[model samples]
Target chain A: MTQSHLAPEVMARARDIVALYPHPRSALIPLCHLAQEQDGWLRPEAMAEIAELVGITPAEVLGTASFYDMLHTEEVGTYVVTLCTNIACMLRGAYELLHHAEESLGIRTGSTTADGVFTLEDAECLADCGRAPCLQVNHRFFGDVSPEGFDKIVDDLRAGRLADEVPHHGTLVRTERDGGLRVEAETITAERRATAAAMAERAATAAAASEAKANG
Target chain B: MTVTDAPKIVTSRLGYDDSHTLERYLATGGYEGLRKALSMTPEDVAKEVDAVSLLGRGGAGFPAGRKWSMLRKAPTSYLVVNGDESEPATFKDHLLIERDPHQLVEGVVIACYALQVTTAFIYIRGEFALGLERVTAAVNDAYGHGAIGRDIFGSGFSIDIVVHPGAGAYICGEETALLESLEGKRGFPRIKPPYFPAAIGLYGEPTVVNNVETLSNLPWVLSNGSAAFTALGEGRSTGTRLFALAGHVKNPGVYEVEMVKTTFRDLIYAPVLGGGIPGGRELKAFIPGGASAPWFGPDQVELPLGQDEVGAAGSMLGSGSVVVMDDSTCVVRAAWRITRFFWRESCGQCTPCREGSGWLEKILRRIEDGEGRESDLELLMDISDNLAPGVSWPPQQTTICVLGSSIPSSIASAIRMFRDEFLLHIKDGSCPQGPAPHG
Candidate 1:
């Protein structure tokens, strides 16, 4: 049964995510990603729906959700601007950009704007040290960002002029799969299965031979 | 010596036009290593790698071949590439993932074959959207080319790779914690002795966890033979390493240098690398590794860049992230920012790390803000000692992961090396550098 909070397509995708791992519990993180992908944030009902789908309790889902910095459990703005103020970025004038951001938005870090447009956060390290003083608008990077560049980005997003610039929070990347490599248990062919068995035998023999050689 | 003088094995094809594409990868005679590896027995492949002494580039510098051999030759073995390059001022893995993803893919596939890992995962960090996109595209391309997935190149061996994107946790950079995060839980590091990823990991099955850069070296090592690879570097610490330069450097980027053959001084001063610190400012201190490593003064700049040499010089070559600070930069402020990063990123699984990092951040902040107490320095050391007992080298008696140990590494080192500046902060009851906080 599809939950009211989750789209049918999203629920199906969640099931597919669960199938990615050997155990359903292993799908918890990905399923949360799916939930956030659909709703932009993990609401209480959304978490409950995901927990039920993954055969876990809502509390367990929340516990996992709260642990990750990305999987927000509350409401946020359409555009989440995360500025890296960690050691590397801090060295490269990231704090100045942060103060600039705070001034431009008229909102401090960790708070959303009154217009419900932007949510600014002071992130630790986005790990883009090569291009220091970086920021991410809805999880996509704006590398080597300047105060003026950040302002233009904000203005563009506000005006919806930068339509394709920033992806939503949970949209990690755009990938087109031609449907190669069927790894699921249901898709293992008979020939492939026989080959897998032979490979295991070969591995054992090869390992034993190597160990003998080492000992000698 | 310049970074160009070092053999560039891992990043050889880094800037080639359309390098991320499989077609371009093939034009440069890529996947020949996978083909060569496929011709040999898995054990023989592992043996060759062991002969090369390919060290793990993911901070710990563990032997990659030894790690592969340690895996139980089972069909259930899993290969998880730790693409979570979350350490502050470190982005070498980011360079690999974004620029030459197929190198990582080819290397990972070869590793899976040798270690008998049928399924693999590349846990890219959340912020790296382009990396995620590029790696995902590369994996898909690998599948399309029959490089990975069922009966690889008609060898009758089958394996599949999946790109798993992590949702931002620095602690997940630790191997066990990475596995925990991969298994869809909080990024809490599993206690060792009872839990190592190789023997028992990922659903209590045999798993091999390697760094992106470490795996990316396999194709080169396998193709070129072990001797050719090992000839480039000093004893045991074989092969070239990617050193990321940042903070007051003229050219702040990733550079490949031979292990131990290159010195920190050369890395910073060579015109081809860091280019002698930006703005002609005198170098005061630098963290040879990422933020977690102990900071060293200018007197020790000649220390070798190898893991052993740096360790002997009372610092680590951890992750090979060299963050330089000029004389104009305040040590107390730098220490506070670094400590604050550890504080914010602590997973809170271990009490010492969780509480101790917070305490360190608060104390350092107070000291930097000119609210220093005379007793606070001693208290900071005491807390660091509690987190990493004795404040010794190769930090010990901490949490499930070395993150607890990492918390005190820079803090204790900063207090020891720049005690005078910290004392000045206390004596003056404010930042001694000037009105500006960062300077």
Candidate 2:
């Protein structure tokens, strides 16, 4: 690897996530988020470390990371403010909220502020539809937000009033657990081998079935 | 006549302020369902769920009992609870995950007992910060309660539930797509043919993927016999369904009312419910279900909120999200916004969804921006027809998953119900109502 981006402790936590699943690859997305949480975006170094941790290629990691809106490959602000302008939110003054936020932030959607503290995006449905016109700051949701409400939250955020709750952009969940589901390392390795064999067998079965269909 | 609203089954634990806490959950007979399910054999428990006819709440309305039964015959290895509720105006699962996480945990536990699965994962939307926290805590609390993990409740059914966070993809809300995301891949849905989760699923083993709301219902179903659950809502809809009412409603919120028996009118107009539209506005149209469902005009307000009844009405109550739009609302603008949502969230794997969604959104944008040609109307429909061929109700899909099929609903519903609005936009070179819908 070019460099070790994750610290010893951070690497342990990443390993903890890997242990939670029967297959280590299942930890890939979570680790991607964790890497972003550490660096605000997925760095090549972090992605390389993750690939090493999960036994996947860096290119493979990028393929997965690029697919999600939240996992960014490039730079992002410390706080990502995504205003929902989808159906429910749009009908509930989301555009107005967006207009106001744009004016207040002095930056358009999809651009970060001069301070690099905030990045604004006009997002899709954030699942806070009952309280329409929702926006998420660093994945923390704020629903039923008016222009004034959005402005107020921004001020609070800038003033560091809401810093404790509104963390840096990728820290969605911070709940520490006693432990995760852990099976022995050898058991997981064996299971992976078995799963690979099963997959190959299924592929053979499908090939034979297709061949039979063609012959018939 | 609409039947009187039934007692809440799934949302029974919702009203209490501390309802999310494990203490509150235990005090309010939280793990009773897990206890009750443990008392019965796995087969018996599965039978009880089957007797209730509990359809999946995460759209598709597949019977939960049937899903488990299918997995029961196979060597099912995992139970993944879908908590990824990202549909516009759909927050029932979010509410369940955030407000009564312990109840959800209890439900997941009961599901494990019935399915006899060892490891279950709760894949919650990553956007839900509080929900992730609560569910994470709730899962841990369940383990402490002996509801999950090692020899749960001394019933000899040990299970582990991991709450996995989704990084932000609406397509991941789809079942197989969810599996792909859980497996740490892109949220592209697996092409269907040998396409049954009961056959091949997570890690190439049989897996039962159920919704959070569907699993949350199990605690209630286990405690109050399946007969009691079945006796509530009519036909296929056999319980109080959580309807998240949004848009122009005065009191927009998630209300649990008897399915099929309750009308959209009651949910949106009743004083105890939506309390009618805000600003004394006259209702123009409403999306009967989620944003994907073809909308219902005011004339269809009396349509029952049931799987069959709504399905018969050309739009399935797909995600239990009812969005009302009033007379002052610009249908063109609203349709554009909905189109934009689909376009932005198309996952970019399928050509029709990837290219078609962007094409549809651009057309809507130009129309809304007053740069419309009358031909644009036909173009929208043509493209919609291309993606969802025939543009018929119970849409035909050309893409891997339903997201491509879903793009046509808003466009078709607007044109079918409000052609004049589109014509007005074209004739006036702008939306006659207003360019800005609510802002």
Candidate 3:
């Protein structure tokens, strides 16, 4: 699985994502996601490729990638079980549920199982508060779960019964979009010039205001 | 009109199975608002929104129309739809996006028309995989149906919407931080004064950042007119609003109700709403707003869900999330969990928020685990007050964003309301209430 280059298809998709933004540097986070999708973890070579794609250094890519919890710099197991222990979930036996997940998965909250098939995390709120004690299997949600319900979910996932609904790690947005407007070459050029002029004017105005305050 | 009598506006199309599709959306009188908005001038459309007095639903209760008015007019102003609903127990936007995405898409196009902008971006949280998929499919379907892209609906107004996905970071929900993330950088919130989206924003250009729920109401506003919406709810809190009810309630879900007409008691106890606490247990306390708000005891249940009313009563109806706690619940554990969330999501841009959140969480956890001194409570107050002086509801912080100040809310509220319970944990050296949680 180790490689110095991103797969040809992923490179093509990366180029498409880059087109959606006005600046190539704006594509760094999405390219990081793309690299994670290609490999389970963000490999050094993949990060180098992304840095080259977005016109930044590899260290800069790593610095930004490390800031996010979803973009893993380290390797993750097959099923990343992220359980919520926030206020809403905690009010609903989330601690007990978390304890159950630890026991059944044979790993601690931030550790991986022996088979490397599952990595459990005590996540913050996933924003689905109605379904308390909610957990995610590689970012897909399961809610209103009890300790027994958690065990059953693990069993189903282990036996590959829920493979159709759940995909591998780093696989977000199962559906593809119909492509963005991407403005148009003429509009992009025009908008870029307009934005540059506005920024220059704004800087000039700020400098004048500061100078006036100093004089007073 | 009262809460029970007010008409459903934003959530009018929910509960239908095929509500997300363009076919079902067109069949159900969707995008008619866009058609009607196209017939009028952009100024007139903004005038309709101004007449409605709709407040922003993303924590801060600023008026949406006034926010649009403040946007610096330029040839290339951008409109960003903030669907990054990352706060705990705040899921109204999640529901609006998951079930009725076409409505949201229609709302975005309508907003673009009012702002007279040609490009927009819908930044949804990354954890919402299905919601992201549905909204993406809806945007594509919208393009195919000729509701978006060049010369929309043959009115010669062109617009482009990019469905941007966030890699998991809660701080990106902040509008300025969202812009930073959109530009592919760490999501540290920018300082205000010159950084308010109306002045300097995304890519150093003027931008209008509207919450998902606020924009979702635009279709209804245009469809029924501003007078129709303003007539439903009274005073500053005009039009119906969505509230996400969670925690100990039996029917914990999102409900669209009138703004000032509804009281906390009705929302938490109504048969069709929260459906009361489970197991016939008595209510102990509740968080009237989102997790960041101070907790309210049972006596404050009669206060109406109005921004002015709640603010006068020493809290805010932030993010429209109400969490209830039954008599069996442990207040210390609940407060500790909330503090823990703030600690995890502090973004580390400021020393007060990052370091303060961690210290607060550690101390709350210790007290919850019955390893507390009576003086630990005072120490908690001292640590919290250092971050936000006075430890009051309208927070004053030592850091850039309000998150640093928000660290004090739960602990301060717990100490103010239930000082004796913390003493019991300290005196008895164990939790008297035990692990009594709700689902």
Candidate 4:
């Protein structure tokens, strides 16, 4: 990845991003974003070119690129599964889910399966502690999984049963105050219809009270 | 408690039963410092800060007063209070901001006056939305009482204070990096030399950055005078520092102590302070300054709990956030957890920090899981060495920030001090130090 090889448009955008900061070298991370956007993954050659563009050494570029899990320094599969295994996720059997993922995919952490379908990596806290045992396939999160359930999810991905319409986990079933389940709608359902009716009743009651006060 | 007996300054403003409301704060001599500062010239105030030699409590330990004096001689210099206390195990700044909002506001006004700046921003942590409201209310109350804004105490100095919440990036705690975040950009730290905040900061004018506690000390210093403020601590590192104590201690909370007066044993073993190790377990290792500072084993426990003393012991008095670990706590687990934090928060700016921290985290994880080779320890050392006290090309003298340097310091020290414990995990393929289940 020589400076000469960068697409002229990508190089221009990288330069512009670097120029935003007072010091150009401070733009290293953002430039990597530009490079990744251009090349899909951070190639060593592209990183070297970015280093030259940002007035830093290639080693520095490589270091910054590899530091974050989000940045893909190598080729990745079409779908990326990032599992959150920080303290909260760990307490909720995230490790079981991770192991299940490896077994299903026939690939270890940091590797893409031979089928070129999925890439898996252990992620840090994603700020979704409320929904423990969560994993994000690309941009969507699949939360609250048992070991067998996680295995089924990977199988569904492998089978193409779940279409890639922006990968998402199932609806989050929140625990209500009285220890009952309150399922918020991730998909349109009869339960969602009941919730809507209850909300409408409350709104009508408030409106009627306001109307009565105006008449008085 | 008598002033001499009670470690004065940082915790002086903290009361267990104190309400954070403006009325409660005012009833307790909160605005006295602001009044005293308003009565004097800004230059005189700056000079007084220079006299006390107070340092920033946000890890760097840069002299607070000296920082104020460095602001460009412009009509509109800015004072930014760094309340982004993002270091793991550091919670003292949040306590002051939440429990004593007016005290922080008073400190801000005094600092703004000293720097000859009418506009100030409290760069708060994004997660501290509750804290933001408390500070905002305090600022409004001060305005209503003429303690801030135009014609404060009949003085011509008018100060406007605003709370700017950050997007919760740990790197923003660094002074230069903080300035970048405040400008509504990604919180990436800029290299120094070509760009120092004092000269070209926050819209390319002069800006003064002070820690929340450092600014909070301003009002007291202005009221008591420099000599009195300096009298409280040792030479050079004058004034009181807030130490946030946590982990395995019976009574873990923030304590205010003079810089040179406190000892490690007194702080940790004193029943009212940290209450020694929990459940009578012997102390194994301790982190003196949040997660970034180097770890100290039991043999190093006798070292005094002061800035100079701690630094001489090959660690820092960073933010004064002390975390203690007992015998049951696995050193390997602790190192792995702290390394993971750095890896997650690396910002991916510098190569050594980004790649090095992730590698270290992965290696530590491997060691904790009993899959580590003997050479893995050597590899960890090599990676950490590259991250700290080493020059990088483009010739940046140190790691990208103190964060990069400090993360490795804790890991390397933990490995050096407790190799047997780490080796046990590798040999047994399980954590022998894992805590027993509660009844």
lDDT of 4 by residue, A73-105 (tens): 788876777786654355445666787778777
Q: Residues B1-439, candidate 3, lDDT per residue (tens digit)?
A: 1247788898877767888888888998899999999999999999999889989989998999999999998877899989999888899999988888989999899989999988898998888889999999999989988899988999999999988888888889889989998888999899877747988888988999999999999898999999999997778999888999989999998999998889999899998898899998999989877888998999999999899999999888999999999998888998888888888888898888888888888887777777878888998999999899988769887988888888788889988998999898989887875532321
**Which candidate model has the greater DockQ, 2 or 3?**
2
What lDDT is reached at residue B108 by model 1? 89
Order of models, best DockQ first: 2, 3, 1, 4
For model 2 chain B, where is the 10-residue window of minimal lDDT?
Answer: B430-439
DockQ of 2: 0.46
Q: Which ranking of candidates, highest lDDT first?
A: 3, 2, 1, 4
DockQ of every candidate structure = 0.42, 0.46, 0.44, 0.03
Model 3 is docked with a DockQ of 0.44
Residue B110 miss distance in model 3 (angstroms): 1.2
lDDT of 4 by residue, B1-439 (tens): 1123633554565664655777777776678887887777878877888878887788878787667666777655678888988676676787788778788888888887777787777877644545665787777677777887777888888777756555446777887787776654457787766444788777677888888888778767766778788777676677777777766677666777666666777778876677787677898888887677778878876776567778777778887877777887767877887788788788778888888888998888777766777788788878877877432211223465666776677777887788887777767766764431110
Q: List the residue pairs that clash in candidate 4.
A: A1-A45, A63-B351, A64-B351, A67-B354
What value does the lDDT take at residue B232 in candidate 1?
Answer: 83
Candidate 1 lDDT over residue span B379-410, tens digit each = 99899998889999878876877888888888
lDDT, candidate 2, at A41: 88
- The true-versus-predicted C-alpha distance at residue B144 of model 4, in Å, is 0.9
Using DockQ as the measure, the top candidate is 2
TM-scores across all candidates? 0.92, 0.93, 0.93, 0.67
- The superposed Cα distance between candidate 1 and the true structure at residue B262, in angstroms, equals 1.5
lDDT of 2 by residue, A123-183 (tens): 8788888778888898888888988888899989989999988999777688865534446
Question: Where does model 2 exceed 4 Å of error?
Answer: A1-3, A179-216, B1-5, B72-76, B433-439
